[model samples]
Target chain A: MIRALFPVLAILAVWVLLADGALACAVCSGGDDDVKVKDSYVAATIFMSLLPLCVVGGGFLFLRHRYRATPDE
Target chain B: MTSRTTSLRVVTNPRPPVVPSAVLGMLLFLFTELMLFAGLISAHSIARAGALLGWPPPGQPRLPLEETALNTAALLLSGALLIVAQRVFARDKRRTKPWLTASIALGAFFVIFQGVEWVGLIREGLTLTSSTHGGFFYLIIGIHALHAVAALIVLGMNWLRLHRGILAQSTFAAGQVFWYFVVGVWPILYWRVYG
Candidate 1:
């Protein structure tokens, strides 16, 4: 089951990374925050970013269910 | 040339349409907008860090956060109302006009609030060239503002169909998808900008 879910998880990860990568850089606008980008290895949190992805991906899946998914062939 | 019955059968097929391409199209358009915002964020971040100029190129003013936040709230509320409108229309036609009217009114109000905020902000000394923050403010909120205007116009047209009793439930679903996106994406921008 875990292996089968990998593709969906991967797609979902890419979705979040693509979005959160931009936002991570986006929120730091104060000129003197002293954010070290190039040399520092920061441990990013799944809690902050991944939660949003799960919700968005799940929203899309719900929409697909409500509107697109159909019965019969 | 005379196969109306067969065409009807095809239209009335037992299986429902997948709408995969349409879903993909929406996602792609959203991705493009993300790229646009990403570019703005990158420019702003680098400049803020002194990697580039101190932004605004020396002629712009800081944005008035107090007023813009009000407009942000307006837009957020409009989205909530739109969902309400869609839900109302999903069941019965009689309830459609009320919800549609509420949605349309809220959307128009949101746009008007944005306009008023922009005009007031500019008068108070903020401009696209005021400073890095000023430029970022204008570019980020301005793009979203433009999208808001376009969405209101589209919703108005869609509203006309609903008022005239010509729209289908499925079509409402289509419009709602885009509307939700417009509403859904704003908080992220608002938080970043206002912060």
Candidate 2:
């Protein structure tokens, strides 16, 4: 699971990049632009570490909740 | 005293089932979805605040805020109907169809209104590529609409099951959870898109 979700976090890392890098796009513009978005690497690192755990944990809770109750009433 | 027989499918459980598990599942799904959108909205909020340009960009018309507000009303009404449907279904499954149908209708109306408003916004000159405002508006609303679509499918399934027979309360409850998700997501969209 860790191996599989690593890429998603990496991609998110790139998104946070926009928070810091690249000032002007005066010359041209387009989709996904491949522009490095600007953000502190520290913040992105924290997010990458945090979000997937949240996703996995939430799914676990949901599944467990579905089975926890008695079927009747 | 009464005795119970065990079923071969153990996961299905040999004992009588608990209260509606589906309700919790739906609620769980809603919470997960809220987190997902919350992430996006948070990013957008931070980015918008930092933008050299105010949202809506230099020339873009301010959002069709009033139109979107009306759409918000449609979703809120749908939520109410779902609550009513859950109540009726719990007491007597036979008559859930009307409330369920009303909930479904309101759900459909919300989506239709969103689509119309999108078209109007485009006619007024907003496109995903046009500006960051346009980008966030389209992406956020589009994703929320997808959730709404999924919620409708859950409703449809529940509706079908009700017609066929009294579905397990867990299943109906699960459906309600999803319905609430559809309703819960709207206000976040409305505030960011218009406010």
Candidate 3:
């Protein structure tokens, strides 16, 4: 099994090395060095990333509470 | 002589769902919609920040902040009315009709007010192709308006069913989930695009 995973690990290492080249697009790079733009990009990224987690997590917690409140039949 | 026939019976006890399936489905749909709005708002923010001449582009007509605030208040009150309707529905279904009617009326008022606001903005030269500000404003707010209209339609249908006394608890819950999403997401859009 170890020998079988060696090629996959090697390919992953190569992909990681070239990840920066993959993000050279204008959208990914913000296409400008303006301070406000950069800040907006950062803030937006955080907002977008955390929003789904919060929503899904909250929903899950709600369901768990409901389940706990429900009596066993 | 000892041939005996036996009948088999399977006893089943089904437990109620933690969340009704319809409400859960609505919640799932709203989750995706929330992400869509998040993307749109994020794009708008990035674009606004990149603008060199500052936001609203210099020549664009300013958004009607105070007027829209009044409209926002109406939408919020409509949402509050819906909550009251739902509570009344739990206790006495007969009395929920008035509260539900009031909520729908306010929602309609909000949509009509927004339409007037759009007409005024367009006359002031805020067309979609006029400026980046115009483009983002219409794109984001227009999507929101579409959602509001669709939610209104759903609520209208719910009202009809209630009038007929055929609305199921799950169905009403589903409609509430959708309308609440429309109500809840508005303030954020207003802040981001208008403010």
On lDDT, the candidate that comes out on top is 3
- Model 3: per-residue Cα lDDT over B1-195, one tens digit each: 698899986647667788899999999999999999999998889888888887788989999999999999999999999999999999999899999999999999999999999999999999999998998898988888898899999999999999999998999999999989989999999998989
Residues B1-195, candidate 2: write the lDDT tens digits: 999988784455355543345665566566667767867775665456556556667899788777777878888988998899888987988888999999899899988888888898899889998888888888988998998888899889989888999577788778777778768767866886679
TM-score of predicted structure 2, chain A: 0.41
Ranking by lDDT: 3, 2, 1
DockQ-wise, the better of 2 and 3 is: 3
Q: Kindly indicate the candidate among 2 and 3 with the higher lDDT.
A: 3
Q: Rank the candidates by DockQ, best first.
A: 3, 1, 2
Evaluate model 2: give its TM-score.
Answer: 0.67
Which residue pairs show backbone clashes in model 1? B55-B132, B56-B131, B56-B132, B60-B130
Clash totals in order = 4, 17, 0
TM-score of each: 0.66, 0.67, 0.88
Candidate 3: list runs displaced more than 4 Å. Answer: A1-29, B1-13
Q: How many collisions between residues are there in candidate 1?
A: 4
Candidate 3 lDDT over residue span A1-73, tens digit each: 9999999999999999877622122753355767777788889889999999999899989999999998766
By DockQ, the best candidate is 3
Compute fnat per model: 0.24, 0.10, 0.71
